[model samples]
Target chain A: MSDTFLPVVAGHAEDGRVAPPSTPRNVPYQNGAPNPSAEALRAQFADAVQRVDVVWGETTVFVDRARVLEIVRWLHDDPTQQYDYLSDVTAVEYRDLDRPIEVVWHLRSLPHRRFLRLKTLLPKGQPLAVPSVWDVYKGADWLERECYDMFGIRFEGHPDLRRLLMWEQYKEGYPLRKDFPLRGRFSRSEQLRQILAQNPEAKYSMEELTVLEAFDELSLEQRNRLRSGEKVGE
Target chain B: MATTTRTIEVELSTTGLDAQGRPQRVPLATDEAGNLVPMTPAPALEPELEGEHMLINIGPQHPATHGVLRLVLELDGETVVRCVPHIGYLHCGFEKIGEYRQYNQIIPWTDREDYLNSPGNNVAFALGAERLFGIEITERCTVLRVIAMELSRLISHCVWLGTFCIDIGAFTPFLWIFQQRERVYTMLESWIGARLTTTLTRVGGMGADIPDGWTEDLANFIRTFPAVLDECNTMLTKNAIWVGRTVGLGAMSADEAINYGLSGPMLRASGVAYDVRKDFPYLDYETYDFDVPVGQTGDVYDRFLVRMEEMRQSIRILDQALKRLPDGPVNVDDHRVILPPKSKATSDMESMIHHFKQVMEGPRPPIGEAYVAVESPKGEKGYYMVSDGTSKPVRWRIRPPSFVNLSAIPKMVEGHLLSDVIAINASIDIVMGEIDR
Candidate 1:
């Protein structure tokens, strides 16, 4: 890449709002049919939907977390809506909001060629849970598990929900939370010990466990100590 | 009872054998509530009369698996009854890591996800970032992205064919295809520094302008590549062993494939003409003319045929892009986005400050999210970006096609023989790193 390739990641323009959506979003469509305007979705789920906002040339509806399951089921099952494909499911940590955690879903209708993004915010608490959409779409099986894996956002009725990337018994906090340390909260020594204990046949090395950046800060003796998994700092 | 006829009474447990060779119970995983819970399969109904059924653990490590993938197969006398795929072996927290790094930093990681098509991943990632930034790339950059992407597809498909041929006991094609792959890699290396991990694209444009005469070399390579493909077709496509092993095997209807989230050749082979390139055009793909190959029966043979045709289609795209290569600045000339050139930075006052701020703090985008899907070799390789008005994205989710497509394995493998598992798995064209990411 060149020096010319530095910025633009944050966007060229500072204005967050996109130019108004091409068509009037207030116009409502028939139920079970697509091209559902922000108003149509509101009309469909009058009580549940909080608001609909267009960001970056797409529609993102901030819906009620409590009735998320019912709204999602309707959106998928409604013949007109038929958002059969669950393209992705992810969690975004706002870090500042009361709930702070927002679960986002990208749903697509193959026949209709329409895309919809639905988001629900969760209140701060332990044992985070949401209704599983695995039944509605078999593809949601792993996506939901991953959401739980990274954000500790559980799916209420998921058939098999467990830690995906991390060890099941791992008690380290959810790794994707804004507050979660880039280098994990626990030392590599403890993490390595736990994984090795669980999987004896695994071929992991000390190189994977120790942070090379920290090694630069260490003296030769300390570096050697780290390589040997010895606690030299304390 | 005939059960005494040398048939071992075996029940396959979910866990692996311990040091003592005794089958061990799989450790139950904790739920969100920290309660130990097993992801056990529902009890299989007892047959009217018992028949043989056993479970086999394929790999967290195995040759047939493209990378580190573990598949637990419940088999009934050489027939797969159920397949439960256990991923995450190669999970490096790529999405989580994206939260800490800049947009450019994520492209290299994307390459590693599907190393077989590193440039394809590079362009797909850059496209996602570019859309989020609302910066329309130059004509030259768009053409370059298309060329790189198409070339990567050609290379990735070669790897897929070679590996699949090996799975089916055909070794000659494996050796033969590598020669073409080496030539393609050399061409890629000529312009970009690395061959395999080619992180060769910038957000607004490419890493560097195409090196002198790179296009002509590629055109020369493409001219000879088709004869090799025709040779492969004659050698393997109609061979008795190849036909017997692949034809009418691992077949699924279009609806079932879609419901199971299949895409790319696997989806197209099932008779669904759904191609992201045509359906959801990006990077001026609408201007290009190429046919999307579709197959009637979504069988292993059909998948094989579709991908072969796809290689031809990619060649066509490459030719078109090469013909229409534009002359202009590859990177957008936005001072806010792109940095000032070295020559300008040394001589100017404002340009120097712009460089310092951009190099240190990075750009501050207005908080927003963008989902961009590119027609990658495998399928719809999408990047979902959520920016919280910071240089780093709050949520950078990769919708890997292999991950979604792999979900259809059980549906395709069930009722097929143990040997057909390899054929079906190969047809899916999975890259484990992408799946596990």
Candidate 2:
């Protein structure tokens, strides 16, 4: 942060403080990065992450997938650089790349009034292996799973890596990816039927099967066996 | 090793083969006491157990859930061990659709995202798009925008308060508040063409000018709102049961609130005075006379109080906006931004051509990116627009308030009782459309 921007950033931090006396009513919009103090903070992140790149007008900091756990641990535990919260973790699918997908985590430090965007690109065809940030922020568990479910970018250390909004037996590829059809293959009722078919033996009687009546019924064991592609008997 | 092979005579029986050439049931192996037992399949090796807990699915359509927000909660009985919110059930892919639509055509999509505050949603998108076009809105347009936004804020809060009461098992307040909310919709309908999804405010101005005596009607509504708020405050704010259910429940420290990117009433309830309007004033908000209310304890009660107080402040702001109503052209004169009137378009050749161009291809924004944040009813509603010097925006992303505020749910309800989940959710005031969009 430069000298001029330091006071403005400091003013924002001070304003965030509980019951600050005489908060600055108006702060001029300082669009440029003018404070050297921010440089030191930026340097700390530059040393830790593998590479920081600005692509397509977005700032992204890349880190090794293997060292994600370490990076998040430091980000949350380090006192001066405490990013105690993981705001969002979303994945973007780039069809042009060899990996074709990247997971991005937006982290924030409330005390310092600072934020950082962390990115990790995984190679295609390789088993997804990124440590979970659930232990650090607690909020990342669901976000990471959502990202995993949407982009097929797995978080290796996630507690439960099941489909979130989509049903368990959904065969379609990740929806947020570029290739995924915006208008899905199935109709609304068909989608519901597919979801209901996942748990066939749950016993929805005729009266209960209002909208989802067309799908065939099977026992839970039978459904599970079929889903696993097992041959029942010769 | 040499094995002695014996030819055994066996009877081949095919009594119950299905049409698919598969047996319906196979003979089972016999266990000790002449009891037949089915052969057990081998279990897949499981991951190492970190800990054990119970799992519960809250909703795809459960009561107390604001919309179709489904939460997979790992619980230890009454206490929430962990929460996983599953969004996208209400996702219409608004951002993706916006890319294909014209600038004005996208306003209705904004209304559906944050349905409770349609006007605010409209203004946020309109302002961002207008800023990109470098269109200067006249004084009358700005004042009208402020009034509409503040009224929408009050309406939004009324919905929040009503639904929050319902979540807490108080049904009467919901009915009482909705009665008042109906009036707001009626008032808005008079100004705009539609009631719920108005799509009222255009990019550089409004779709239509305010009708006669609209200010008096708004003033009358504003005057009545305070009494209705008082009734709600008396009914819920001080009720012993209400206090017991909310006070100190799902509380978060100021640090945690900010770090989690929590904003709106949730952040303000945590004693942070970071209202985007007050911090980053826009649309003549700097001249508005109002107070930014903050709460002491960052709990459900504090959030409730903050929103209630905010409704009052919104009314105050609305009063000032109505008092300072200016007379001027509602839309900017720039033909590139706003379409000419129908009369002019039909009569004049130049107007016809300008209208034709604007309708066929949208206004081309400058080659740059800008983010504008507003203190929406829910929280900080920010619009990030990237234009490539084209008629259509390259990228349009909304930093939705409900989406960010919903991130604090698990942290807020971590160790709290399962019953309190509804209270915490109500405090967050999440709209699934906004969250999933």
True contacts kept of 2: 0.08
| Chain A TM-scores in order | 0.67, 0.64
Against the unseen true structure, what C-alpha lDDT does each candidate score? 0.75, 0.69
How large is the C-alpha RMSD of every model relative to the true structure? 15.5, 18.6
Evaluated with TM-score, which candidate comes out highest? 1
Off by over 4 Å in 2: A1-163, A185-196, A200-234, B1-57, B72-84, B346-349
lDDT of 2 by residue, A44-103 (tens): 656556665432222446777887787778777787767665556766544354643566
Reference-based TM-score of each model: 0.81, 0.72
TM-score quality measure for candidate 1: 0.81
Best by lDDT: 1
Q: DockQ of candidates 1 onward, in order?
A: 0.14, 0.07
The alpha-carbon lDDT assigned to residue A104 of candidate 2 equals 68
